[model samples]
Target chain A: MQVCKKCLLNDNMPSVRINEDGLCNLCSTQYESRGIVNNNEEEISSLIKANREEKYQIILAYSGGKDSTYSLKMIKERYDASILAVTFDNGFLSDTCLKNIRTVTDNLDVDSIIIKYPAKKIIRAFKYIEDGKFFPRQSMERASAICNMCIMLIKNLIYYEAIIRRIPIICFGWTPGQVMTSKPLIKLNYTMVLKGFENIKNIITSRFGARYEKYFLDDAFMRENEANMPYLYYPFVKNNYKEDSVIEEIKEIGWIPPQNTDGNSSNCLLNSYANQCHVSKFGYHPYAFEISNLIREGYLTREEGLTKIGNVANPCSYKMICEQFEKITG
Target chain B: MNIQAVNEKLKEFFENNFLYGESFDDINGDESLIDKGYVDSIGIISLVAFIENAIGIKVYDSEIVPENFDSINSIYAYLKKKMNTQDKAV
Candidate 1:
């Protein structure tokens, strides 16, 4: 298969068109707009100062991963936003992740909320998606079905907290590749949002027995926050990430890389399982595009990017996936 | 230019940039991009930006609903109306 000369993306990936010059469609399109942009420091500080009336200015979706750990450190040290770190413990999180979470939050003196829904609840959602694609083809190319569901769940839960606490910003530490946008904040069109979220909510309603459908957001939540929609922030997108620098910098905050995860992940074991399913189903890694983008934008070396996607997922994660989803197989 | 030309251009952009399937000819212009899984949450945002940059019609947040932006045909119709209004105002 032909691969892009500029980045590591190959023709095997869906929606990829490799040019005669040996550049992939994604690389060609981004070539003109590629530049380093770490320009949101002032904006974040101003928002935090202005929104002091709210208990917390930002509710950062902390995944206890290296990227997020770096983001947490930057927010506290660089921007110094009044922040509350929130994590949804998607049952497959490494034990090391929990330790990192506790140590980092305690050291930073930031309050935190760690929500662990019953594993049965998350497993049903996983099984439901096994039957069909639950997201757009583009989104599916970016991440696995299981990872998509987990991210949606985390966003919904963090958004809920932001609305309740009157926080002005809901933050995530998405890398430039993961974010796919250079914008500092994501302006969510409500109609577009509901359209995106409706299916995930339905998955939850069906699996959680419809009785607790209220667990998902309803019109009441929308009505209450109409005038004050919390701004969805991707702070990490503004920073030009160098992966090694990020890992080394975040280590001072007690963040340790977990040995249990596959090469693609630092915190969640399910990520390995998800990558396995994605490759088997799609013929290429789910992160093929994102990793290529990282290489294109100089966040990682091509060799480093290749190594990240080359290694197979953790074997133990396959066993964990079987144990979790077997509950719903009947 | 006419709405047909505008539509052809939009289709070309999506085909060259984002479409995962074989050809735009197979897609019904009236089909909802969101409902059909052609575009997701972030994809919709990118679409709006493309519309603004391509046609100079700035879409506001309230106008991002299904009626105007759900399908390629709907986007065409909205563009026609908007361009007509802009011409009249001028």
Candidate 2:
């Protein structure tokens, strides 16, 4: 029950060390000056402006979520950059999220790719994810297993789309809360990515069979196009993350608050169920780790962090999620 | 901290937290965890964050390559180098 005074991360997480000063080890590290690189805004701008080859300068891994909607607006308004917005419809997106995707993309003149698989296959993949132990244990601190599965798949599909198209920048509207890294802009290391991809390949292919294997990059494709694959950019992580202002700003465009999700998410209807399952097994809210970063970065107060993670008791939306899922899987 | 103790802790952490129904008892220390499918790209991100948080070392973004982090032996060697550098600075 002990939460850090400096940030809202509780003692239940093994990585948290709430010291005598009442600051958690994560926050307390600030005094030691680790000198991590944060925000390559100028570099990102220069990179984007300099790259004139691709028709769409950045292929955004859009989730039709609040963050991506706002990022689309910013990238368009600021750089006047051409963008290809991509969404992986996991069959669990709230009705509001779907509508927001249409409204925002239509108004912004942003082209889109909605990657959707057969509903039965997608649901079966999710069922495997929900069975637990599908991903790294540390990722459980940040998101539920189901959410992690969705994110991993979405990222892969986006990467595949980007590489095939030879897009220069694979951008994600990841929140500062979500991506706590100091470096927002990252050059892709093909070797490291390939090495890391083995785990994902093993988990998904082993469970989903060869049907899902085509989602990954193949050696033949890499032999021809590996040199042209794009790097990734996270604009939200590097910029000031004022959620209140962003919500207001994005509201002017087309986004409306999703009705079916829990407080921590506005895109996925499965969020409440995922949060409950994650907390039931892990002894802490899944969003607590990610939300704690928001508090530390001044985007949210400790009370707000506590409130966000405190929603584990939200009426079980598992039935509601299943209703929508069954409608499709049938 | 003793090098063996640090290695043990690192291995213990990976096994307890990163395994997926596979037994780590037989995983060779020199084998690439990535190649063996014990760790993946995203898992390595978490591992790096854990190393930074638990070991209190500022891992340069460049140091996140497989050369320094792909195996238990490689990670221990990397950590020893980093700690030595810190100590010399002190």
**Best TM-score goes to which candidate?**
1
lDDT of 2: 0.73
Which CAPRI quality tier does the interface of model 2 achieve? incorrect
lDDT of 1 by residue, A259-280 (tens): 9899889899888778888888
DockQ of 1: 0.34
- lDDT by residue (A1-330, candidate 2, tens digit) is 777887877778656657898877668664232434544656666767777667777899998988999988988887756789999997778788999999999999999878878778777777667745766556666688888878877777887788877677888898877774434566546666666555656777897799888867665665567577677777786578887898999999878988667888878877877777777776777888778878877888988777766766336466776675667555
Q: Give the whole-model CA lDDT for all candidates, comma-separated.
A: 0.76, 0.73
TM-score of 2: 0.81
Q: Candidate 2 chain B, which ten residues in sequence have the lowest lDDT sum?
A: B15-24
Docking class of 1: acceptable
CA error at residue A158 for candidate 1, angstroms: 1.2
Best by DockQ: 1
| Backbone-clash count (model 2) | 1
Collision pairs in model 1? none
Error of 1 at A12 (Å): 3.4
B1-90 per-residue lDDT for model 1 (tens digits): 566766776776687556874587787989988778887777776676566555455565566677887787888788888777763210
